[model samples]
Target: MGNAAHEEVIASINSQISETNALINAALVAGTPTDKLRKKLATLHGDLKTAQEFEAAGIADEQAKDEAFVLGAGTEIAASTIAAVNAELEALGVVCRIEQGGDRFAEVAHRIAVALRIHEKVREKIGEAAAAVERLETRINECAARRATITAARLDGKSSDREVNEFVALAADIDALNGLLYDARAKLDGIDDSAEKAAVERLRADMQQLVSATLIEAVTVHVAQAEIALLDGIRKLHRTGLKHAPHRGSTPRSHYLMNADLDFFCRTGALR
Candidate 1:
């Protein structure tokens, strides 16, 4: 399907899934008959499978592009200029880190340049992390819908053999999706500098303190630290791929809470 059509189908299916989940929730609370709920759930599963297939297809293309971009970015950064990094940051809505001093201007610029180099180097990992999170979200939503269907069936108190079988299947699906979501989140959290603002504040404080005592020395040290921090961010991106970082876990049942941020990166030219 063309991109527009694909998006439209996805939107329609998602709306249906939402409505189905709501129906399942109400049916469960009201103790609807297992057979009746099972029929509805069967339809929901069919739609969900279609949606999953579309997502799978899109992921194939996206992954290919991601691989190419990452490799190319690595090469580009090796010889990248400050202007290139500034352009990239501007595209990402990040302010360029340029120094406004006399003698330390070049040093500060070099530091920012290197940091952006690291940023470019890890760009693909960021894209992959975003994609993984999207996949996890879709799976989790589908599982939740399935879980609601199973719950509705159980509420009937006379679930048939088929319903029982489906319940077991849903259990396994939810378990697998939960694991995927956990891994996806760990990747994101590992690379996330959610504490970046605080870190910057500390650095600013230090720079101010050293302005009088040891101007050039403090600026050099701070620039080095900035480069090191950016390098560490890149290291974490690779380590996330190794799956060695601590798994702090995904968000709550409100999975869409993170999708907005992910969508921003995916939809914007950030991935470019």
Candidate 2:
């Protein structure tokens, strides 16, 4: 569903939850003997909180997918550019391996430094790609708003001076939006992939290292999903009123999580 539709449903659900909670509170105040209903409502509240956590987790998981895409794409661009330079060095029989014995270490380090420099260009290109996406997204949103306004004016059917002016503005906006869309598409299509693919064919240890680190970042996709599930469970228990509140446990487990994880990593240089 679209965001507006989802929001409408969420608002309705929230209203129901508030009404239920108020009813339970009123029953308690009036001595109406609604213990069973109170318990049921408590369970429903737990489930609602769980659903909210799931919703949050789902958003994080989706964002992880975007992050992985950007990092993976940027790494490929950097690796390929680095590989192209390495291939030329190989053709000239200049060994650039850091561990390959004598004086070559300096040259090898220099070459690696040069490859790292290419990463700066890679970063710039990545920034440009993000900016292009933002521009397209902004323009599309503006176009949608203008179209909605124009549609609303037409539906009114009065054809007043205000409506005529709105129609004129909408026409101008549509023209600008069309041009912006074309520019965004052209920028995306102009990205070269053949060079990146060629770099994969002639991969180096450094490129492998880069790819490995990028893959580690991609691992967050799964981590994000897992975190969502974990939070849902925690929220479920916490929302279950007095009976199942997580902190109510007599012997709460000492396993490090959240801020504890930060402390552990900072102190021990290890992640739990």
Candidate 3:
């Protein structure tokens, strides 16, 4: 039986013992035979004692289970593939303390696991964002070099229709790179790390400078106006994405509350 069942058994036996003692008292007051009633009370005491023992054993078994779970979770966290997660666990002082098995221990371990999972998810997205940013930077640099070459040719009075068309083509390339940057920034919507966020912002600023310079060197007012419109579009998309993005550092709690992964972890005690 479970601990609660054992407690119920103890309670029932105690009630029986109490009723038998009442009978014995009434018999004494009436000067009647009370030997059988006394024997029944003694039997009830024995039953109560057995029930209490069972309850204690059940509690011990539960404690053992808790201890095992805590130990296993600690091991898993220590060996997590994400170095940042492991470092966070260490900073939180949760390592090597799982032997303290109880509700509190379980709660702390669960919180750690949830945080680790959230961090892993964010890290993966950030990696993707970083790659996207790199691609955008590469394309922007190529466009800038091409613009510089065309501008030099124009200054030398060697400009032709083909050069004008190529210069205008740089606007299309910038538009595409802007789209890539927009996606990268979107991926960072829920990022919690300050350093990572700052790094991305710096990369964005540098890219913007390159783009502005390239557009200013446009050979005609019409082309410059078009490039400015493209830049404005990028700024609009960025502002909209940031405005609608989930609040920073809120991803962990939101994910924990709504994610099926939490249910799976609660059932299996295994990290995905």
Clashes of each: 0, 0, 0
Q: Report the lDDT tens digits of candidate 3 across residue range 190-272.
A: 55666555554554354345334433442345456666976676566555555675553333333223258756877899968
Find the candidate with the highest lDDT and give its number: 3
Candidate 2 C-alpha lDDT tens digits along 1-272: 32334455566667777887788789889988877776767776776676666666666765676556555554555545555545655564544422222232233334444444444445556567668878877876876786677678678874578767776777787688778778877776676545644443444465456445434444555467677987676555445633554455533222223577766886899978
Q: Estimate each model's TM-score.
A: 0.30, 0.33, 0.33
Question: Model 3 residue 79 lDDT?
Answer: 38
Off by over 4 Å in 2: 1-103, 153-160, 193-203, 206-272
In model 3, which residue pairs have backbone atoms overlapping below 3 Å?
none
Candidate 1 Cα errors over 4 Å, as ranges? 1-111, 153-160, 192-272
Model 3 stretches with alpha carbons more than 4 Å out: 81-272
Who is ahead in lDDT, 1 or 3? 3
lDDT of 1 by residue, 1-272 (tens): 53446777778877876787777788788988557656776887787788778877887876676566645543443234334434554564544333333333334333334444445545646677889999888887887787787788779876678877887887888888888889888887788543443444554354344343344454556667777986576566555644643353332222223246555775784742
CA error at residue 102 for candidate 3, angstroms: 22
